[model samples]
Target: MSGSEPAPVEDRRDSWEGPVPIPSGANETFWEATLEGELLYQRCEECGTSQLYPRAVCTGCGTTDPPFETSEGVGTVYSYTVCHVPGEPGFSDRTPYAVAAVALEEGPRLLALLDCDPEAVEVGMPLEVTFWQVSEEAAIPVFVPR
Candidate 1:
């Protein structure tokens, strides 16, 4: 698929075992982009700050309805932790997974699953985005070392 198009969900059974992302309001476009293999963040037109967990108002300038922008899906690990305990249901089987706070190239920092051995990731490491489609309307962004 083209860069603008998301990779198709491989199978519906392999994503998160916890409560899935439900698209709502300002977050709806963000989730929709994931299905097409795109990552999105909201940018404040007034102050030029970009953010994630999409919001209706810009935190930077208090502007209502910031515009959505597509991310390049590239980032660097700012920090991370290995999860020995399941954070949610069905995650017990995924012990030793990594959860990372990544600083995207565009300036937004997002928390995402790291698709690599817990011992294999490091702060400042470069990463690229991949999606784990969990529901018809949402796909969780995961990262892999680049």
Candidate 2:
């Protein structure tokens, strides 16, 4: 509801070969927004809880199929871990990347790749979301310093 959707800068890395998200029933809107340069989350109308990795019902209120809201795409680092080993194929050369738990300003926490030097991040660092279009139907949110 607060984050604006801006055209994403293309991700330069060509070695990435993880997985691409295929939009489905519950999370289709989230993936759709990514292509348009926006990030989406579900907010419950009844209990007012905001969450990521979209779900069919409110985790707080248990209401069915909560609506989606756009994120301001800004957050703070909550925690992180640096990976020196390739966790999946096509990532062997990308050793020492940081994966972080980012706490969004709007109230949800999400785990995303931190697009920065592993040594450059720390708890509470400010971040902003940018999408990397992994496929024509999907993009993944990667964060960098705001």
Candidate 3:
């Protein structure tokens, strides 16, 4: 190879050096509940559907707005995969971790990392929510075997 240098490129995704945007109206109650180590989700009063990544409207029904409620944080593995490739920057240290879509008892499915033995995870495995404080205002929810 010639004695040349490549230009430096910046990763914009990792540029989030500041606090994360708490997604306007959805996560207010969820974060509030997190302060007390509780997990929260949106429950549609109109259709009785519980959903996550909280939203202003129910996915099942076209309700103008929905209500927030605390979740039991207990769930079962709806689906999962062992991530051999790190999907995010901070997760490099946690390579080969298991990520799963857990269906909470209340009816919402949340995607989070499974903090247990990868070999122990199964489609119907019971799990519980746990939080890791990523920032002063954000605590990411992870799951462990129940």
Best by TM-score: 2
lDDT by residue (tens digit), candidate 3, 1-146:
01122112222233333234363566676765554566778888888877888777789897866888767778899999998887776666667789999998888898887878887899999887776554455566778887
lDDT of each: 0.85, 0.85, 0.71
What TM-score against the true fold does each predicted structure earn? 0.92, 0.92, 0.81
How high a TM-score does candidate 3 get?
Answer: 0.81
| lDDT (Cα, 0-100) at 121 in candidate 1 | 90
Give one digit per residue, the lDDT tens place, for model 1 in 68-136.
988888889999999999888878988989999999998999999898988989899999888888888
Model 1, residue pairs in steric clash: 6-36, 6-37
Score residue 114 of candidate 1 by CA lDDT. 91
lDDT of 3: 0.71
Which stretches of model 2 miss by more than 4 angstroms? 1-15
Question: Candidate 2 lDDT, tens digit per residue, 54-81?
Answer: 9999999899999998888899999999
Deviation from native of the Cα of residue 8 in model 3, angstroms: 41
Candidate 1 at 119: error in angstroms? Answer: 0.2
Candidate 1, which segments miss by more than 4 Å at Cα? 1-9, 14-16
> Residue 13 lDDT in model 1?
48
